[model samples]
Target: MVRKPLPDYYAALEIREEADEVTIKKAYRRLVLQWHPDRNPADRETAEEKIRLLNIAYETVTNPIKRETYDLQRAASSRKSKAKPRSAPRVEVPKEFMMTPLGYPECFVRSLGRRVVVHSRSDDPESNFQSFFASTKLALWWLPEVNNMCRIRKLGSKARGDKRGAAAGRAGGLNMAFDPQKAKTAGAEGSEVRMAPANKGQKADSVNFVTKASPTCEGALRFESASQRGQYLAFFPPSHLRVVPFLEEAEDRVLDFLFVDFASMFKFITLEEVLQPIFSAEEAGVWIELAKLQDDEAVKSHFKEVMGKDVWDVEDFQAYFEGHWATFEYNAEEKKARMRPKQERLAKQLRATPKAEEVVAAVAKTDESELQRLPVGALARALTALAKASSTDGEAGEATSAQIQLLAALRAVGKGEEEKCDIPAFELLHSAEKVLDLGGDNPDDTVLVQRSAAARILANKALKSASAIEGGMVEAGFTLPDVVRFLLLPGAAGRDLLLATSCVKLFEGRSIPEQREVLRTAKSRGSTNTAAAAGTALLKSLGGGGPGDHVAAPDAHVEMVAEVAECGVRLPAATALLRRMAATANPLKLAEALLALASRVGPGQAEDMTHIAESLASKGAFGNFPIKTILETVLASSKDDTLAALVVPAVPGHVYFALLVL
Candidate 1:
């Protein structure tokens, strides 16, 4: 059952339903002042009752949640009344246009046995109401374009009775249309509106343009079909709808439609609704020229104030409104000039702090190379300052500048030969590992470049010691996939050694089954680096490398063999699979086994392995193997020394062998 309706608060306040927050507050204050009990001492009881109702109304409407709940309850009551049968017989009234709750212009049309009428304006009642005929109402959707062009559609019979017009939204209705050509005749009127088939749904034919009424017709407006020249939509002497040619003399008696503003029709209005048409015109590049024709200073100043607040508050508002003088008169260069002092103040504040002073002074003087000479802890402190500032949700351009400076300092400190790991630089890497790990997958391109550079520097230093790798994983909270992504960087110095060393340290002290689970967990993360790294680590664990390679724990070699055994091979048969793979004469047999291994894995795992193999093979690192057939054929078939070919000078590579094992 529907609940009882909320009290008529808006009627009590004597304000329109679309009154804004400022207006609502103003109305409440005015009512309270006029009906205060002290001001009406002779009738204190009545005055106090009036003041009490006014306070209740004001409280309900001002609180947003209360107002929303009140509106819902009121709407429910209205719908319930609409659903009930009327006790009295129907009364025939004149056909007229009325505004729906959603602010569409609709005219009622009588048809068949049904009789309906829109509530006509009481101030200007129709003189010949008995002669009106019945038909469907047409709802007009005003489009954003030149001269207020709109689309008119026939509202379904069910929708016509709904005050909200919820059933007659923008889509799926019979529409009216007109030709594309503008009115060429020298007269006040335009073309006729034609009834368009519902199935056609073509936008071009349905557009109609409206014009402000001439002085003779006072507050009314006229709609003219775009293609039908010298005609206007009008009502005849007895209120019958028809398309008629324009005549200069007729005023209130004919040839004009009253235009009702949305504030009077819609129960609630938002700023978004008001801004949509204006922004549409702005985006279409005509708002500037249109505003020039009007000479309203109050309007221009109000708009400037609104847009200035947006420019100061929104992240990218400056880029959007830069140099648009007509709309908001915003200037990007001037805004930057205004912000220069604030940026200088921030820089001065940073320089006053002893921990950040030296780096800030160095950066201000454009001496980034001098930053490398600072102590490791000091350098890390400086980097942390800049990185934290850069990652803030501040203005986009400021963050970008901070990120650029951070990268420059990083490059200066990290610049050295790969063979000689500088003591200060390695210590800097240790100190800044947290900062590097904090860099996530930000959408900004500069952030990604900085992250890749930091990762490369860490990968270079971490390759020298397994303990550093373990520290990064266990203490710094770096996952195996994180290390894998760092190792796969384009500028990383010793990726192969780092990948193998990191994997061994990560999977150490765990069982063969636990190690397999770890590898599965890494591949399941859905990162290209994790899958490729897992495959490469697995191949290295198995005895896929040459004789000079370091031997792992005995059980590590059996993990992939177990993976293969699960794919329809018996355990005893799988134990000799790798041995037979090395001696197989038919490369197709090796290719089939690789395909079967890939088929049992997750999506994109095999593809990632193929890409890594192809990229390395293109650099001439993998000898005597056809580039196209490298992944298909076993790398074990190659010459013994070639299987351990290096990706870089210090890093022995095994990814190609891993691709074959898959």
Candidate 2:
């Protein structure tokens, strides 16, 4: 007879009733991709119908209740087929099975309910029967298909109310056997039966034996007494009857006995549920062992599994492991102390070397003009060499030389003296400006040159506008001296003069004192070397003072004297201005200017001015000299001057004694 066709949806999807949602969805994606009408236009109509049916089957089977119902119907149909009588057909066992050591028994049942009869084992001894019953418990316990059928039957009876009374009777039997008092109390409320604990004084109603119905059978069978079945109804429930083992002999094995008793007590339990506690205990033990082996090869294996080989090669991973171990061994204070110096050393090395591609890029982009140049690739190589240099004293000497070369290159950039190099002048200028503006330990001389060059650039750019020049100079931290020097270059002198004159005019009222103070400070700081030269040049340009003409006083003498004196030293130009003033016919004004000029003259020059002093005395200008009056008028006022004046006793004493004698 031909087998009845499976449901069209099932056949379309090629899935069993037992297929899970994930399986169904997978099958659907595959079938839809293959047999969808769009994919197979030649079979469009049939493919479309198949696709529709597939969708319906997937939807129906994916729903839990619908899937379960479908499974039951399929199972019932299978059972009905097995129950039907069939004409005997010639059966041929596969030769491989016959050649195997284990032979078929007198009767054997296949998974699909096909049976084979063997006349040879039917009349076998009772001892063989006993042996078969002894080994069938594990086999019976593992038959999921048979257990599933039993579950469905039990559920079906309960749904019809017929199994409720039977279930209640079983629960009553269990209560009477193991928990009579609690059972009586629970019975009043019709509560569920509780399984007896292993330690409880309860004897198992039946012992399950592992038996093969035939030598060729792969699984075991289970049996229960008609009266004891109620007490162990959940364990040997009708749903589980197919796989139940017979009680033939008592075995002292705990696992075997426990499995039998457990199966009888919780008949409705799934195979997975039955094995859960034991498997969970085993899993927990395995985890404990795993945790204990954290430093073992197993841990390495696990790491390999989770992170792959590359993780161990990473610097961060190495650092973390090293740090972890270091921390474990050393206290916080020790660890900090040990790490601090090493970290600082590492950072120093990092800074000294260009570690990143971007830093290398920056170095490459640097533009060193004629005044400031360095080979970019050579610098990088030097840094890399320094990075690799040993920290030992001998190696350090070589490293130091390398460092000096690097610093020299940097300084050349600062000085704007390097040949056609790529270093950025603006960066060097800004760095120099920062150093000067912030004023720290004496900055490198190259830094000063850089500041000077930057000031010159800015001043030259701003030459037309005095405000712009001052703003640029001030922004660059250029001292007034720097401005003067920057402006003194051949092309810049005229603009410099204009700028200075404009500044004097603009701040004549509000900032004259500040301007004077800045010039005064610059003078004290000996920054007026350039300024003095520039002023003398400008005076000569105006024709008031000829070169080497000490007899003539320039028209600019008052301002020039103040500025030059503020410079705190007398150049030849300044001495010429002083000599002209002292020789004037207005001897009093001349003497005053003479004394002012004398005050600023260095001691070495003042010592050589004895005749000038005697001349001032003969003119009687010394008697009323501001120097001598200060000696008697205020003791404190003479304190500094008296000491300074004594260095040239002829100048001070002749003026003072001449006043007394007169």
Candidate 3:
């Protein structure tokens, strides 16, 4: 015959009975890698089959206890096969009869024990005995006995044969007709028989019978009624003895059932596996009590441990001991009692400040390293708050103190001096200005300090020359117009001043629609005020007038003459003023006044006069006509060389005189 192949699990991974877990694992790994689906996707079915077999073989051989059990079963099967005879067919006994064979003495004794008691009565004693014997035989057949060496006994007395029969008949079949001599002989031969009249209400005297007697049975019997003992009987043989094994099996089954129920109820996992990893002993105790409130001992014990000898009070537990720190304190009777209220009050005060949210968020997010390495957002917020507070008017003193504290903190964090906080400094100045403008209390003192601080910072940063700096100063309540004018003035000396001048010039040149764009561009380039100043200077240079004027007159006029004369440009000055008078029909007095002043000035003061005259001419002014006439006449009457040269040079005088005459 062809031998069947070993199972695929055994074949695939080459696992043997001797293989250890590591060996099994290595073999499984090798096989799995060779047949992995990703590596051999086209032949997936075959690969998957191989993988399944490998897993099964590895699992079986790697587990020591399972391997041992498998080995024992395999060995037993092999031994049984080897011991069987090949020539003869093996006779199989029913499992129930395997321990006892038919025709054995035990079998006959069992059959005898299987006899049931039977009763009969008749006027003839022989007929009554025969009937009883027939019923007993039928009972024995119905329930066969397993052992042959069994016995029976009959109790009570029997009468002599014919006379007993006659008495039994007379007594209405209640008496037995057994011969005492015969019963005595049977008893001597190891048989027992005795008879007497049945009791008044009973049908028969007594009966004893044996079937297959279990070791447990010392003549065990069950009776339907002691009063009707002759009515019926039932017997159990050695099978009754088997009840001990059956009962033992039942007890084991019951234990198994109980174990199964327990496994289902409690889950088949140890305390270590299911509970211990997740919770510490104390936590577990708390959890168990929480789960089962009816567990009074657990609840009480847990409360004591958590609340420190207090009776269980939910409010107290929650208030004082709910968290890991357990720093909170609670009194059961006084619900509001707490430890460290002052500290809590301080915390609340800190939180109630305007920048508290920002501080809290920053603090919450900061780790120890971050807090140490950088300025925490909280410090920034606190500084911002102090700056704001300092900027407010009535609160100046407190605010200044806060600012000092803020500066200390900044220095502690290595931010250097106060000028480092430019934005905050500017904001402080602006706030002071507002307070002062609104007539807030003692605003002057606050404004002065803030402006001084701002100026210092601006100087340090070289922002004074920046047009953007002007914008900031303007925001800080320095009037933009005044700031621009100040910047354009002659004495201004920084690059930021030049920049501011350039910005003002650009703004003036731009149309209304274009001005905002230009201003934005200047601001973006950090030159807003520079542009403004440049525009203002251009307007002034073009004789377009200052910011106070809408229309500007030509240079050949009274204001222009005054400007030119102030600059000592006497000719232009005299010409511009005389022309203005001629146009307006003014008298000669103003013209004469301008000429006289010009004539009195010596050559040594000529430069000064020129500067003053130029300035006056630029203002469109000239003097009165009488002085102009004198200047013309004098110029005309000059004699000879140098004097004539000097006289000829007074051309502004002649021009002024001619315009005045017009």
Candidate 4:
């Protein structure tokens, strides 16, 4: 007996296998709306079939038990199919359709009546049918045809050669009559235009026009009737669109027109599949705003915006897709390089001015690119100058001010790539102020303090003798107690735990006695923060609970927990530190944090991690994160089936997601 093949509920619903309940419902609802019979009356039969399959898929997937059973069956079926002998299918391969550069080109052929709507080609505005007509803003499809030609089908039409004349043509199709001889004459003399009468027994009256660029207007197209001599389709008076005589000077004349692309495809694809960039949905949809395409200047601007080129064509679009649209990415490094001169100017001003705060304020006001370009060496000198100046007065306020500037400059510099700084660790630590003075009055100062502390940790790691940097820090008056305080601070904000954990990690570089001091401080404290507790746990886990016991570096799990906590998702149990990741963090940062946490998960922790991930996800812990980013994060991180159960919706209707998953 043969086992029945399991149906693909996920495919029918148009979602990923790991899609959570929320994603399933959303996909179901969207597909229902799109394929509802009432909404798609023109294709009611197809809509009905779609709605039926969608209901089955939705019902199966939305139920936990049914979905589980189905998933199992699907997995078994997949394995069985793979194990079976490979056999070529009997069905013939479909012909491949090359997506036109003009993007679906599915638009209505609206006629511009003789009232001079846009411009006056003739000296007299009234005579120039080429220039003006009011747009009805009505939409229609410009279906593709063979030999660089297309059929201009009206909204309700199916047949092309309707012989029932104008009324039938309006109801079904239009027949274009073109006289080749007369067309040549009209082209040469720019005088008269005429077409031969329709031949007998032509059932469909549909007119086909050769697609060509308009000679009169840039980016606009002029459609001269294929079967008629010099006759072109134009909007008649009273808003009726029909073919008439083309005259260089007359009441009725040929004119250029615009095309508006619509989502017209010969085959069906899920909304999610369409949205994925890897699918190159460009072929599936037509070009953007037809009005822009019709204007010479607008075309240039459009290409520049999308492809980073002042001008582009069909070939360029093809190449762009083939290269995965890399040109579209904004290169901040290049942009920052462009602002190098501005950064140098600011650094010069910083060196010249004794009021470092004013320069720091100027740095704050400067564009991120300019700040990124600011020379690290120059910044170090300015910081060293501030520290030296503050030391002379022995004023706490002046010292605090220098530290404040240090924090601001470090934060700004931190925004760019770390490798760009290029300064040696010793020089940076020696030249830049080592102490993080606690003297600010603002409530926001705590956050700045935490971030600056974290930044300091990162900076110290750059030292040549990173392990013994504690000695240098002590000499600079930032003692072991100060490091302990940073590590034991409440993990209330995104960077608080990060600062704390980073501080604990620094003990690795300290002497054994110094490490003992950190452990003793934690034990001595009445209330211990998460980081201190983690250190205690680490000491106990490694069988060293005694005072003389040596503390080891933080375990991978501890560091992972700290990192996730730093992303504002507190762990052991995933709870958010902030109201939303979107409020403070961007998508890239959030994705990185989640993936980093995931990558550290051992096999034994997969189930717990999945639950934590799911709970965090259900609570919107990730914020208004992009689906593509999350999908990429998930795909790159893990292959654990249990973890895969943590559903995150990707770019809806993107084929790229499907392609990548497959």
Instruction: Return the top candidate by TM-score.
Output: 1
Pairwise TM-score winner, candidates 1 and 3: 1
The worst-scoring run of ten residues by lDDT in candidate 4 lies at 98-107
Worst 10 residues of 2 by lDDT: 148-157
* Alpha-carbon runs more than 4 Å astray in model 3: 1-397, 405-451, 458-482, 485-506, 510-536, 540-662
Q: Model 2 misses residue 199 by how many Å?
A: 38
User: Residue 551 in model 3: shift from native, Å?
Assistant: 10
Stretches off by above 4 angstroms in model 2 are: 1-418, 421-430, 435-522, 527-532, 538-559, 562-572, 578-589, 596-662
For model 1, residues 1-662, the per-residue Cα lDDT tens digits are 11122468889888887777667666766766677655765664476567656765665575453465455434433432112111221111112233221111122222222222233221112322232222334455544554455544555533322443313455434445443443334233333344543332345444454543433223335555544544555543222334445553443224444433322232222222233344444433222332331223433333344222111222232322321111333333434211112223223323222233334444554444544443233434455555544344544454455446656655665665333432333334443454554334453566666765765654554444334543644443444444544444444434544454455555443334444454454444333333334444444445434543233323334346435433332323332333333232233333334334433434434343343233333454334444444543334324222223223232224544465556
The Cα local distance difference test for each model comes to 0.41, 0.33, 0.32, 0.40
Ranking of predictions according to lDDT? 1, 4, 2, 3
Q: Which runs of model 1 end up more than 4 angstroms from their true locations? A: 1-362, 375-381, 388-399, 418-450, 465-494, 501-506, 511-662
Q: List the residue pairs that clash in candidate 1.
A: 109-134, 109-135, 110-134, 110-135, 190-231, 191-228
How well does model 4 score by local distance difference test?
0.40
Q: Of 1 and 4, which scores higher on lDDT?
A: 1
Backbone clash pairs in model 3 (N, Cα, C under 3 Å; residues 3+ apart or in different chains), count: 96
Q: What does candidate 3's lDDT look like per residue over 1-662, in tens digits?
A: 12122243445677665665456556666666676544664564466456545544554454333343334333432331112111111122121111211111111111123222222121112332223332222111111232221112111112233243212322221122223233333331211222233322333223222222222212222121122212212212222111111121121111000001111111212111222232333432223322222234544443344223334245323321211011223343433223323233223223223342333333443344434332322334344444344244454554544444433333344333233332332333233222222213444444434433332223323223233444554333333343333333222344444445433434434343243333333333444344444333332443334333223333333343333333333343243333334333222333333444454445554543444333333433333324546454345334212122223333455575564675
The TM-score that candidate 1 achieves is 0.25
RMSD each, Å:
24.1, 31.6, 39.0, 32.3
Cα lDDT of model 2 by residue, 1-662, tens digit: 12233364566678765565456656766766676454664554476456556655654454333344344434433332112111122122221111111111111211111111111122222224323222221111111222211110110012222334213322111111223233234432211222221111223332211111221122212222222331221121111112122222212100011111212212211212222233244422222221222334533443444223222322222222222221111222222111222222222223332323323233333333411333332333334434333345444443344344444454443343223322222222222233232112433354334434433333333333223434543443444444434334323543434445433332223233334443444344344543443444433432243544334443334455546554554444554555544443344454444445555665554433443444444555434546654343223224334223223233466555655765
Candidate 4 C-alpha error for residue 114, in Å: 75
